[model samples]
Structure formats: C-alpha cells, structure tokens
Target: MSEPWIPIVMRRDGDRLIMEWSDGFKGAVTWKALRDACPCAGCKEEREKPADPFRILKPNELVPLAPNAMPRVGRYAYKIVWSDGHDSGIFTLAHLRELCKPLE
Candidate 1:
C-alpha cells in the first residue's frame, strides 16, 4: 500500500484553511466548507437528511464558520473547534486533503 499523505503545514487564514502536504501538494478550503463537512456522527446524520425547503434561520442559528482552534489528534488528524460551539469532528489528514482545492 502507498504511504499516507502527511501534512507539512496547516494554518487558518481568515476564512480559509491552508494546507501543504509532504508530497508538495498545496491547497486551501473555506472555513464554511470545513464546518459543513464535519465528520462527527451528528453532523454526518444531519448532512444525510434531506434538505428542508422551509428551513428558516433563527437569530442564534446564524453560526460563524470560523475555527476557534484546531488541535492535533495524535499524528493523523485535527479536532476543530468551531466558533459556532460545535467541536466534535476529528478530521483525518486524508479527509482534509480531499476537502481542499489546489491553491492558485
């Protein structure tokens, strides 16, 4: 099997998460996309549910996509703490790499 793609650098730049892999891949993803792609069970379920046509945003539901912190989980992942108060997803290196687009 091929070796895992390791992250060489990870950082938040405003609303984007910038990453560089050990294999020379560099990319960035918006904070909103990262939050939406949360891999926690609850978020996963929520994403799987059909979209509600009448969904309305309440005042408190206006969540900011900014990450308050991204702490390393062992050697393979990061646990993101979002500004919206949700902090359960542990994003693996491979998952994160897939979420980003090549930086122009």
Candidate 2:
C-alpha cells in the first residue's frame, strides 16, 4: 500500500490542532479528544480502567491548548500543546490519515 500523505504544516490554536496534508487536505483535531487519547504512559494506563475508561477526563471536560507551542515529532508526528499546558499526545501522520478517511 502507498504511504499515507504526511502533514506539511501543523498549527495549534486554542483548543484545536490543525494539519495540512501533502494531498492538500486539512484537518482540525480537537484538544479534548486528543487529551483524552494522549499516548503517554499515564494516559494509556488511565484508559485501561474498565470502570471508567475516561474518568481522568470528565465527559464535559474541555481543555483548550495554547497555539504556537506545538512540537514536531521527527517530521512524521506532532506533540500537541494543550490549553492546560500539556505537551503530550503525539499525533502521528498515519493517525491523521485515518482521521481523514471517509466513513462508509
């Protein structure tokens, strides 16, 4: 299979992470979801709980990240900077590709 297009540009403003793919598609990933799915060990462990998979994050919780503090992950991913100052959640190029996939 062909490699998915990489994000040529990444930007974070407030509570959103915006990416521009090489194919010219743009995506806006929310900080709340990203934070809830942060790939860090702590977040991963928290997600493993059966009783409350997302208890660390309340259903209505929303974290707005600051813009201009996003980190690049080896040119293929980005570490989002959340409004809560959380600089985790490594968003990979492949992950973004999946998000843009059309649902059947």
Candidate 3:
C-alpha cells in the first residue's frame, strides 16, 4: 500500500487533539467530534439509528467528561480511547487527515 497521510506531530490541547500533518496542514479536532464520529462497530450502530433531537444540552454540559487517550496503532492508525469509556475505534491516518479543517 502507498504511504498514509500521517501527522508529523500529534498532541493534546485540553479537549482537542492538535495535529500537524506531513503536508504542512495543522488543525485541532475536538474530543466531542471525535467521540461522536467514532468509527467502531458500537458507535456505528449508534449512528445508524435515528436521533432524538429533543435532547439538546447547554454548551457547558456538552463538553467531554474526561481527557482522551490516543495511542498509535503501528504506523497506520490511531486508537481513540474516548472520555466516556468508549475505546474501540481504530481511526486510520487517512480518516484523521480527512477530519482536518483547512487552516485559513
């Protein structure tokens, strides 16, 4: 397989992950987004179902309950240990790269 778009630097900044890509793109991804978009089977199941939009929380209450842990999976992917005890997502480097917002 061809080389992946790996981050040259990956670090945590409060409730977000700060990543600098090999192509010089740098961005921060919030823990909430990461958790909500978790690519694990359980999370995918949760996503496939319809959501009850009535349960919107205040901004303060919407924050991540705990810090996240991201462990590298060899040189191909990163495993996300979510704050709420969800830890089955093995996000690939390409997926992570796709999540990046262009630095304006």
lDDT for residue 15 in candidate 2, whole number 0-100? 59
Q: Residue 96's C-alpha lDDT in candidate 3?
A: 80
lDDT of 1 at 18: 93
User: Which residue runs of candidate 3 sit more than 4 Å off their true CA positions?
Assistant: 52-63
lDDT score of residue 61 within candidate 2: 48
User: Which pairs of residues have clashing backbones in candidate 3?
Assistant: none
Q: TM per model?
A: 0.89, 0.63, 0.79
lDDT of each: 0.89, 0.66, 0.77
Which candidate gets the maximum TM-score versus the true structure? Answer: 1
Pairs in clash, predicted candidate 1 = none
Give all candidate RMSDs, comma-separated: 1.5, 4.6, 3.2
Q: Residue 4 error for model 1, in Å?
A: 1.4
Sorted on TM-score, best first, the list reads 1, 3, 2
Clashes of each: 0, 3, 0
Q: Tens-digit lDDT track for model 1 on 3-90?
A: 7998888887888999999999999999889988999999999999999999998665685668889999998899999877789999
